[model samples]
Target: MKKRSGAGLRARVGAIFVILAATVAVVDGCNGQNSIVGGACVTGYVACADQCVNTAVDPANCGSCDVVCPSGVACLDGLCGGPVDGSSDGSALGDGSSGDGSAGDGSFGDGGDGGCEPPFNRSSACGACDVVCVAPNSACLADPSGNFVCAPPCTPPLVECENACVDTQTDPLNCGVCGKFCPSNLCANGVCQGATPGDVVVLGHDYSSGAAGSSQAKVLTNAVFIPPSNPLRVLSYEQFADAAAVARVKSLVQSAAFGRTVVFTPSTTSADLASPTLAQSYDVVLVYDQQGGAPANLTTIGASWVTSLSDFAKAGGVIVALDGAAGQGGMPQLLTSAGLLAVGGHQTIPAGTPVAVVAPADRIGAVVASPYGVYNRSVSLQAVEPEGPNVIYVAKQLVNGTPANPVVVHKIVNP
Candidate 1:
């Protein structure tokens, strides 16, 4: 090409630059239409089918311009499947989502907290950051394979030491305490040669004592024993009417309170039940009911039994109402009214179905072994709002899968 004059060359170069600019715009603008990339698409608008449209509140183009939300779910203020609350400030999931469902900085190993702790490391966090090592019986420690996990200490006399759950009460290799070898083959009561044979007062009772002279005492006694907590006697009171109640009484008698029972009275007409001495003597009262009603005049024997129990509870005596007791008359009403318990109701779960036992941070799980158990019938009481904030909720709800209502609760009354 021949050299041109300065002005002519400059004019031709400017024209070529203009042409290139136009061509570049068309090439990068998504087939000459609006695109999510570059200046063609603006914020507060989405690029869909050659157009930039406001998807923030559009029913047809919901969260994204192309997303036509279903009629069943609403498209609300740029959020899909949310109610039209008339405000738009919350962040939402975008189509550019990671398959794992987490959008922010993702570096934590499988289900691990953000560089905080491993999933199975019980000492730091177990299962997840939110789920920690729990229950007095359980502790965070390593197993035989050396992986961190949450595990229960070996039964009673046994203890956890040197990465193992060892029976310190009997182990010769680690007798009395861990690593304390015994000279003889005897390790008793966790001490070398300290074995002392004594009567184990494992006690329990059935709520219903069948037909006047009949009994299910053998069955009650034969069934697994519930360990009694001594020096804190529990009065296992039951009616003679309910088979279910009686069956549950068999279970209740195993509570720590049972070991404290000053007297054993299952009959509805038991004089001790109404005795003021009973309230003064015992630390706890476990009431098991079948018909949801007291025996004739039982509530009014000398002193109103209901009044006595209420006073006892008010005076720091723990009153535990067992199966069907929620449905029991005035007593339950008093308890419910006081906000010590959720109100009366019952739900019979399907046979063999395990109800999820929600245990809070307390000694509850230690007393009740399993976090889940199969109960044919459970006391389902609708929770009532408490008068004051003095009420302590032990467990919110028991559920097979879906939570129905509150089950276990506690409260210490004030004068």
Candidate 2:
């Protein structure tokens, strides 16, 4: 009797399991429609990018995802044409894969600092008020297309070098880093020293993709001064800072090899910055003008670029940095990685902010024109002070007569 009862209970449990399975299938919708409770959009809204915004009314997300409206417009219906047009018609059209995710332009006040702003709203200067438009005609225009000038439009043979058109075959004022005059020696191949065709490899915008603002267009056209014998190769990118870094590297070469064999390459990405074989290939790696303000590729940094750059430095590869592009704002991470930026060493000041001279007899003082105007292009000013024993006060400027207010400094990477 006991055995019979156990068998009956097992049969009953199996029957219950089958019924539950059927109910679950019905709940999930077998006919292609989802099970809706309390309406699909009104209360049970699907999660979109960046915020908990209602895509039906959010301007950033008019109908589809990332389909943002202009600054003064609002999202209506399944489209965003002008100002507010029509209603949503009580429908939820999502990208289908819905849930809380990272910030996208799904709408305003959704999350992650109000998601995305309109393209024309560079008034906030990148929409975050981080960038300040100092130039008069440069009103933060959102370069609508890619077809823009990448190189200086100088007629071939008559190259435009340093704001003036000159023939590379014979030009001394703009030879190498410009003003490297030699009254006695003949100018050969733009070099005041040797005219022989040396290995001149340039990682620059001249050979880069003609993308608007990818690499600094000036850096490439200036290559004319590098001489005709050296091979010019560009390692460039589409972002401004990344491209500027490439220019910075080139400048480093210019500083060292002003009249020597000018071989240079710039890093357009973190991968380029941290190339494993970079130290082997290049004699000196210049790091400056890294990322700039109002950059597009902020979070897309490579993990090993800093390490790679540091390894190159430690391996005796020379690194020359002019501005804080590689020292502070642009590639502050590199400074930190190379042990240059310390707890109280990094200093920052506003652009054009006047500071008293502390070390006018130093190297920095020898180069700069005035105490003010340290950083003119960037809205925020940043710099790293000298650190470690080898850290030297090339030049120091003070804001309020204090030792901590150093404006110009140089820190050794390894020592």
Residue runs of model 1 more than 4 Å from their true location after superposition:
1-232, 240-263, 270-274, 292-303, 325-344, 352-354, 367-371, 385-389, 396-402
Q: What is the TM-score of each candidate against the true structure?
A: 0.35, 0.33
In model 2, which residue pairs have backbone atoms overlapping below 3 Å?
A: 50-103, 51-110, 202-233, 203-235, 204-234
Q: What lDDT does each candidate get?
A: 0.41, 0.37
Report the lDDT tens digits of candidate 1 across residue range 1-415: 5667897555444533432342243233223233221122333445566454446434567767678866544444455544332232222212222433122212212231131233435433332232234444246566587744555645555577665878876886565555544445676765445322111111111233222211122222212222121333456655433656565454444442333333344555545555655533554565544344553332333243655655555544555554433344344343443333544444433333333335344333223433343333444445444424444333434454664454444444443
Give the per-residue lDDT of model 2 (tens digit) for 165-240: 6665556554433333433345566545432221111111111122222212222232223322232222333334
Q: How many backbone clashes does candidate 1 have?
A: 10
Cα error, residue 124 of model 1, in Å, equals 62
Minimal lDDT window, size 10, model 1: 196-205
Which one is best on TM-score? 1
